[model samples]
Target: MLKIQEIREIIKLIDQSSINEFTFEQDGSKIKMKKQSQEVETVVRNVVAAPPVEVVSTQPQPVPTQQPVQEASAPKTEETKADTSNLHKITSPMVGTFYAASSPEAGNYVSVGSKVTNDTVVCIVEAMKLFNEIEAEVKGEIVEILAENGQLVEYGQPLFLVKPE
Candidate 1:
């Protein structure tokens, strides 16, 4: 196993150099680091699972009784659905937490009515501590943002709707 100081030095050297990826293996342990051209860096590690915990809720749940209200909104829902039926969906490439911006202080990459090109980065998805940038694959204006910031998204789930130009 590499000592703490040695590991720190290796990380410093990798950061100073232009290498995109570095890997080292000794015995049964492995270490890998990857640097993104967009300034994202990820350190991959093995994770161990902990025992599960059981929780019991005692709070009473409220029952919903809004059938009439739902019926009244059905037509409006259908109309809204029909309007977006022609828009293209930008689906997630992997399961991860969706982020509207690179950082909390940063502005959102895209919002409703925002224009995007094929290579435009629309959002960031974080899975296993690695932040993956998701791009807009079509040239269009964003019609909707389906996922909320920090919300967990599943693979192939639609994240945005875009009206193609």
Candidate 2:
């Protein structure tokens, strides 16, 4: 069971974090919370326009033509998505700070191109002062490291992309 102070602390931390939802259960007690999404409306108002320029020429002037402006498209991540579609994604089990190494003085547990077994410890996620070791869960070579050391990671966020054997 969690005390009121502990619950309040958790709520404050969650409110300052990017986590959209969080759930915890222990000792037959459960707590779930979700943040409401807020949409911001932006209004642009100004009475400003360049006055039309008047040009006088003796020779016939070429007709001024307006070219269509192409809207910029969003960057494509589909290629990368397709490439990793067959890979196994290792995700964080709980919201916490992700650490690539056990400590600042220690080397990283795993890196890109590192091979790992299902039981291999890949990283650590610290939550509520508890350091939880995360495992690969699948035998594969790490193709990508998604989270940075000391970065706040949300529950179920992808921490690594592995190419399964």
Which candidate tops TM-score?
A: 2
Worst 10 residues of 1 by lDDT: 52-61
| Alpha-carbon local distance difference test for all models | 0.76, 0.76
Q: Model 1 Cα displacement at 108 (Å)? A: 0.4
lDDT of 2: 0.76
Q: What lDDT tens digits, residue by residue, belong to model 1 across residues 1-165?
A: 677687666665555444568887775445676665444243434333544332221222233244463464356667788988889999999877799999999999999999999999999999768999999999999998988798778899999999999
- Whole-model alpha-carbon lDDT for candidate 1: 0.76
Model 2 worst lDDT window (10 residues):
39-48
In candidate 2, position 103 carries an lDDT of 91
Clashing pairs in 2: none
- After TM-score superposition, the amount by which residue 153's alpha carbon in candidate 2 deviates from its true location, in angstroms, is 1.1
**Model 1: pairs clashing at backbone N, Cα or C within 3 Å:** none
